[model samples]
Target: MARYDVPAENHDRVLELLRQLAEASRAEPGNLAFDIFEDIDDPTRIVLLERYVSRDAFAAHRETDHFRDLVLGQIVPLLTSRTVEQLDAEDQ
Candidate 1:
C-alpha cells in the first residue's frame, strides 16, 4: 500500500500519472491488483493498493520501466509526502 500527499497545484497531474501507473502495473506478470483511491476528507491525499503473487513479484514491480518512469520520475516529484507499507493477509 502507498499513500501520497500531493500539493494542490499538482493534484490533477498526480492523479493522471497514477491512472497510467495503475494501468501499467495491472498488466505486469505477477500483479494481482492495482487500485487507486482518493481521500474523501482530503482531496490532495491519494492511496494505492497493490497486490502481487509473491514477494519477488512485488520486487519485480518496483523494477519495472513504468514504475520507474511514471512513479519515481514523474508522480513522486509532485507529492508533498509519500509513505509505503507492506502488508500480509491473516490466515483463516
Candidate 2:
C-alpha cells in the first residue's frame, strides 16, 4: 500500500496525475493490480494498492520511465508527505 498527502490547493491536478500514473502502472507486465482510493473526509489523502507477481516485477516497475519521470519526478513535488509498504502473502 502507498499513501500520499498531496497539496489541497492543487487537488484536481494532483488527482489527474495520479490517475495517469495508475493507468500506466496497471498496463505494465506482471502487475496484478493497481487501484486508487481517496479519503472521503480528506481529499488530499490518497491511497494506492499496488500488487505485482514477484519482487523482480516490482523492481522492474520502479525502473520504468513513467515511474521515474511521472511519479518520482512529477508527483513527489506535489506531495506534502508519502508512505509506501511492500507486501506479499505466505503463499507467494
For candidate 2, the TM-score is 0.91
**Candidate 1 lDDT, 1-92, residue by residue in tens:** 99999989999899899999999999999999999999999989999999999989999999999999999999998899999998884548
Model 2 lowest lDDT segment of ten: 83-92
Q: Which prediction has the highest lDDT against the true structure?
A: 1
Best by TM-score: 1
Local accuracy of candidate 2 as per-residue lDDT tens digits, 1-92: 88999878877887888789889999999898889899999998999899999989999999999999888988888899999998884563
Give every collision pair in model 1: none
lDDT of prediction 1: 0.92
Sliding window of 10 residues with minimal summed lDDT for model 1: 83-92
